[model samples]
Target: MKRLVRLATLAACLFATGTVALAQPAAAAPKTLRYSFPIAETGFDPVPISDLYSLTVVAGIFEAPLEFAFLARPVRMRPNTAAAMPEVSADFRTFTFRIKPGIYFAADPAFKGKRRELVAADYVYSVKRHYDPRGKAGRLYRLESAKILGLSELRARALKERKPFDYDAPVEGLRTLDRYTFQVKLAEPSPRFLYVFADGSLTGAVAREVVEFYGDRIGEHPVGTGPFKLGAWKRSSSIVLERNPGYREVLYDEEAPAGDERLQAVVREFKGRRLPLVDRVQISIIEEPQPRWLSFLNEEQDVAENVPAEFANVAFPNNELAPNLAKRGILMLRYPRSDVAYSYFAMENPVVGGYEPHKVALRRAIALAVDVEREIRLVRGGQAVPAQSIVGPESWGFDAAYKSEMGDYDPARAKALLDMHGYVDRDGDGWREQPDGSPLLLEYSTQPDQQSRKLTELWKKNMDAIGIRIVFKAAKWPEQLKASRAGKLMMWGVGWSAEQPDGDTFLAVGYGPNKGQSNHARFDMQAFNALYEKQAALPDGPERQAAMDAAKKLMIAYMPYKVHVHRIWTDLAQPWVSGYSRNIFVREFWKYVDIDREALARRGS
Candidate 1:
């Protein structure tokens, strides 16, 4: 009877232990968002890096004072790290900003085990970095041209004195009003200056201590008070980011288009969750077209940001979601991309570059001969619209109905122009020679990608019909970009997207001062320069648009660059992805994205 009593006691203890174990909660599953970039990022450093892919990563890791609303259809601006929208003077020359208190940068070794707070001084230092002679800023011209009070003078003094920039000196135009407030005094009225504040890469605050500690390696160690922190980086191969534990709480703010059923559904799905629902993000650099698309098909990546044009037909046969993929619960979103793809002729190259009438005729003839429509239909898989203007359709001065010779493809006119300019077959070789009677072989720059190969094939056929022999120069994108900036490339095709919806951004490409920067073609015309400055100071209206129109006509007349087509892009998201609408002006959307933990967990199991 005593042994039975002991056995009963043991059983009671076991039962109590089992009950406690059952009451405990299970570990929460991690939410991860995986995606790919078609091009390799240079680095995260904002001032020198100009590539779109690098800036996209930088946007997520850095915080600007203002940001575009995630779901707003017209791309509305809202306060990000700032306490509120900046106050501007009636003339628009003076602007003041108030930073929010209590924001802290993500913990880093540079802080020496102490928390670093983001303050107005950090912004002051960040702006000074661009003016510093040592930084070699790629976008310095934009700020200098804005006529920021005393800022350009500071940069000029640094160059003249052959010394480092003086960051401590008080500049009349840019000064802090207090601990939390800063003011910018422009020399002239700059109505669109506020747009500069919205881009994180240009205006993102960086702590001086962090910059000093990392020095030249600051690009590798980006310290910011943003939603995500760089957890690991494999240079060009892969990049991974984890949610910032110290990130200030961002509540759900659904500002979608009214009565839009699709967006309303997404708003309801992410209605209650704190932003950055995804705990981690994994990014891979897959430059090839096929593998990038296939990874999405295999479900290895959660989103395909821009589906490859080569496989667009396969993904959406007849531009509709395929039946086989619909069963697996995939979503496809297609939109007209606000960008321009064009080919520029280096104005310094002896063969293709000259201001002479014949030189101009040769370029125009080539532009007219190349069939943009055929290229779009075949190479781009009918995913692009013929670009009528260098200024994108979304810009303030763009006119959709106003057509120009930029988009024309008349082979007969091209042949006639070539004949008038002394570009004719010599010695029955059936290939046109230069006006100087030298060989007229055009060295067109190209990449090794499948799409590039197809485009090159089309160009060969088009040029062959015009009696102009052409050869291709193949190089990696980075190398070609560096060469293009140095005026080493004869001709190269590239795309430029607007950071802000302004016509000036595209018009600035022809401005003489921007040569080797935005103006890769080096087309320096005094008349265009005068118009560019005149329009920049004018308000967005008929007067400013008229100036822009005159500028675009000059660009087309010279034919330094041939604007090809504005692209239409298709992006795919898996069933588990949520809140995936794209804002044209907003590049940072990772924080708004929510990964379904349960669905992702199911797939893993």
Candidate 2:
């Protein structure tokens, strides 16, 4: 009777206090998107880094002043960290931007217990870092060419005087007007300079204290006011990023481009919701193709960003998804990328480089000898179109109807040109000799990958047909990039992607001033350079088109580079994943993607 009375009293007390327990559901699992990089990333620092893979990682960790709307098809630019678009002067030489208030960087030891709000001064400091003589890399060509008032002078003084960059010095071109406003002035007109602000990889904001704290290891420690923060990283191996707790409230709002059902569906589903649907983004460097493709098939990877060409028939046969993959609810998105793959001759090389007629004929003949169509069919798995010019598709001034001899593959013509230029098989060795009767040999820098081996085989066959000896030097990508930048390479094959809507980026490769930078070939032609500048200054019209057309002709006429083809990339995603569109210009893509955890569990993914 005492026990029953005590239990009844306890129950009554629990009921009175509303403390009775009920069954609760388990907490949902953290949403994560796992993907892979075809190549290894160099570092997270935006200034020195030039590779696309590293820039992709940088875009996720930094905030730009402006950004392109994710769903806007005509590719509309919108203010990101800025409260609104910049106020531009009529002459296009001056621009002003207003930084949004209350945006804070990810908490770091550098903060010293105080939240660091993003101010206009932060941007000024960030831009100055690109010109600082202490450790700045040479991405300052575009800005230098723009003649950003006193900026070039400041950099020049630092370099000439052998002193540290004057960060405290006031420069008229780049200055903060107030706490939230910043203005930029150019000595010359630049109507398209605003596009540079939208590229976070080039113009992202970086705090000074953070730079000071990390010192030489700044690339490893990225502190930004972006949506995601670096959680863990193993250089050239794997990288992990987690949701930023202190990121400002940024909703996913966009106007879907007309006639695109996929974008419209994504916007309809995620409109007005907070951005960055995933909790974590996990990436791995898978240099080879087989393991990466198998990882996606096994569900270890939620997204296969680039389907390997070797497995194209297995992944998508006859330009359609394989039945096995389709049954597993996988989706394939195929599109032509705004990029070009080409092989270039080192213009300063002793054997192949010169403006002389015989040397020019040697390069033009070699360009004609390469079977670009065969490379596309065999190595690229019929996933590309022959490049007719340096300009990529979808960029301004790219005319679809335009044609040039850049893509022609005529071995007969190549032999004729070579024979006409005194490249004869002398000394009975069955190999051509230089104009001076010296042995004519070519050294091509190559990677040790399977794709490179195949490409090398084709190169050997082509050169053998023309009775010219060729050799290859193998090295890792980073090592090759360093050597290439220093003009140590005799010849190399690589790809370049457009950074903006305009085609100016393609021309940078042949620009004389871009030598030791984008001009890996060290190609310097006054006629080509003049045409490039003229086109850049003119608006998109017949005048600009004519200038660009002349520029392409010069590129082909000189044969500094053998433009191969424009690639077509295909990305595969599981059904549980949503909003996996391949953006042409933007690098940070994980923000707009959502994973259906419930469906993931149900489907056993």
Candidate 3:
């Protein structure tokens, strides 16, 4: 697909004169923050595709089943969004939740723009959509809905046979007590039910009116009760959003006892606070990093993300960005990336036969040979920090102590492991060979971007010294992703943004169900799967923690992939935007923000 670079260029021109201003006092005009990124959002549908660009636009206006405030913020799992939380019945098979009243979807002209209250039927409708055979909502199926009473039977008949599901049927165990109340009779208790609600894709409650209104066009015109409303979406160029007045935050008083940190954070951000501050937010698609930085530097854009490495040394130039901006010390919010950028060695269809092996020695040899920290410092220009695990330290269940056993530089140990496994270069050809004499010359695929290429080249230099020949293969983003999923890759560079704050999102891809869908390396671990199942059945806290730790440790032990680096995203905001906070993923940028009136005045000045 051709990127709409001109749309961003035109939008850049649109705000060039800076004529558009938020309605505010002449003394200090509120700032309109213009954020730009290289990737273009494909659509507003939250069903899961790599591009998170459009999700940001949609999330701004729509509330899902769960909410997150990036890193360090507690995750909120709504009762309306979840079937139950905290407690599981003694029978360990049923969970129930009572919904709160007064919550409503965004007002659209179709609904007369008046807030429409949400109901239990809405959630039932949303969950059923995922079970639809025709619905390509892969992320939704990641949750083991079969554990929910009637869901198991429906899943057994409709899903097992791969047939279309009739969502309107009367399921045996699913029932609604009232308009705002619902209960699910689980086949067994799932302590991690709260995690499912917060999975965004799993828990996002959609209005029945929305499903019926657009029918199939709901992806284009989604309606949710989020802080913002979709305004104008000029495909490939820019997507705009306006504040939703119907939205209210759950406020917290100092008197409130210790509860869910995720719940508390949401209440703190929105409760009693008038959001948006700015009338509209414009997201520009600027694929080339150089041009994005140029626009921000020229004051053509209010905020810029993923600032190119070239500008790292110069982002703060003696207050040159906006003059008085230096006096404010440039508010920089740093948080660990929910997504870890890593390199994977695909064993090819031949190495692992028809399936990839979950071997410790083989993966350890690969991990030991690679020097991750050095690669990050040199190739990434010190923009990234080493990542030992796929899940960052900030993620709810991630274990810092589980950083892969393949510690700092050790070429001798790497070679020793291979030699012990009978992988040796007997011919002195500078490449290791199997017992059959086939050379271990693997092709490494990566995006054509400069940084990725450099990282790949670094891998080549390090691995080649250990008698492993790695040839670099370059492909565009879409091509690379397609090939990776198809298992047509021998090795590749890949990254993931946490769909929520847990290991469940990362673990879902590699299991049998997701196989080719997301598990690019095509590795299947039985121990990991068992742990995931156990974690799901147990309630949140220590029991679930122990199970998750086992799974995480197993993942690291196998070394299915090498963690190159975790990152702290940087967004350059033109001194005007006030409540702008960094999100764990770039797509969450819309959630918490308030344009600065003073910044707008300075732009005018």
Candidate 4:
């Protein structure tokens, strides 16, 4: 009786103190979405990185000042961390934005448990980081053209002194009007200046405390105000991201263009729903296509971004989901990506690069000899369209009616042009030599992979037909990128996806200042550079379109790049994945994705 009274007294005391509550069953398990990438992400730091794969991961962990609407057709920009769109003045040379109040950064050791509210000064600091000499931002030239007031002067001063960049230094171009408001002043009218903010790298906010705290390790420690936070990362193997517990309540919303039934249905299904429905996202890096495809077939991954060409027929025959996969409730999403794949000729190389008629003719002949149609059909499984120019579909200044000799597939014309340029099979060895009887050998840089091997075989066959001697230099993607940027590669195969809907993004790659950066070809032409500058200053209209076309024509005339095809990517998602769609401009789609846990359990997935 005494023991029972003691227990009763303990329970009574616990209840009186409000420590005891009714027993309840455990909550359901958190939902998770699994995906894969063909290549390992380089790092999370946005400033020094240019690869899309790394930026895709960064886009989720970081929030840009402006973002593309999740489902908006004709892609429109929307304010993200910013309270609203910036106010433009001074003939489009000045832009002012206000940071939203009460926005908090993800918890980090740098904050020391105190809330780190985002401010306008953070953005100013972030933009200045791009200009730092040590950063080596691949897209810094995009801002260089804008001539941001006093920013170049600061960069020059830092370079001259060979000192660490002064992050606290103020510039007239990037000024904090108040704690919440910031203004940008450009030397000239920049119609596309907003795109600089819309870009994932340029507009991502990096807190000063976080950067200073992490120092050289900033890439591994990314703290932002996005919906997801970096959880675990094993280099070249796997990465995991968990939901941000302190994320602000935001809903899925978009303004869809009329006459798009598919987008309309998607908007209806997910409109007004709270975002970041998935609890965690796990991404596995599977470089080889075969293993990546096998993982998808085994149901280990929820989504397969790029289906291997070998399994194209097995997964989607006649452009429809295979019967077995359809019965299993697997769906395929197909669309023309806003991108272009091409081979660039380094203008500094001795053999392939020059302004002389012979060198230009050699590039033009090779361009004409390439059978992009066959590449699309055999290599890509008819999942691409032959590109007419550098600018792909969905970008302003991409003219479907535009015609150029560089994109044509005419082996007869190729041989004739080669012969006219004095390139002939000297000594009857079946390989063309330089006009001066010098050994003419072209080196092509390619990744050592199944797809690249097949593409190289095609290239060899085409060159053989035109009597040109070609050799393949195989390197990994990252190595090839480094070599190309250093002007070491003679020719290389690469592609570019639009960072924005503007054609200026593509044109900037050929600009003189972007050499050793995006202009891997090192293509510096006065006429093209003049036209590019004119187009950057104009709005989207006939004048800008004309300049864009003229620039494309000049590139074709010089043949710095042999444009190939615009890929039509087909993405597959398991039934358990919900609210998933490919956004043309946005890479961070995890926040909008949800997992059907009950459905996954029922299917044993």
Q: Could you tell which candidate, 3 or 4, scores higher by TM-score?
A: 4
lDDT of each: 0.86, 0.87, 0.63, 0.87
Candidate 1 lDDT, 376-471, residue by residue in tens = 888898888998778886778988898999989999999999999899887688999987788999999988788888889999999999999999
lDDT assessment of candidate 4 = 0.87
lDDT of 4 by residue, 1-605 (tens): 99999999999998866643445546878788898988777788878778888888888877778988877766888899889998999599999999899888889899999989989988998888889989877778878889899998899999999998887786888899999999999988998798778766566888989988998899898888888889999997999999998788899886556986756776788789887888899999888889999898888999999788767888998889999999998878888888889999999998999999999998999999999989988888888888888988888899888777856899999999989989987799888899999989989999877888999999999888888889999977777877788899999998799888888888887899899888999999999999999999988799999999999989988989998998888899998888778787888888887898777988853
Ranking according to lDDT, highest score first: 2, 4, 1, 3
Ranked candidates (TM-score, high to low):
2, 1, 4, 3
Single out the weakest 10-residue window by summed lDDT for candidate 4.
17-26
If candidate 1 were superposed on the true structure by all CA atoms, what would the RMSD be? Answer: 2.1
Model 3 weakest 10-residue run by lDDT: 249-258
TM-scores of the candidates are 0.96, 0.96, 0.79, 0.94
Candidate 2 lDDT over residue span 267-325, tens digit each: 89998889889999999998888889889988999999869888888899888999989
Candidate 2 lDDT at 329 equals 85
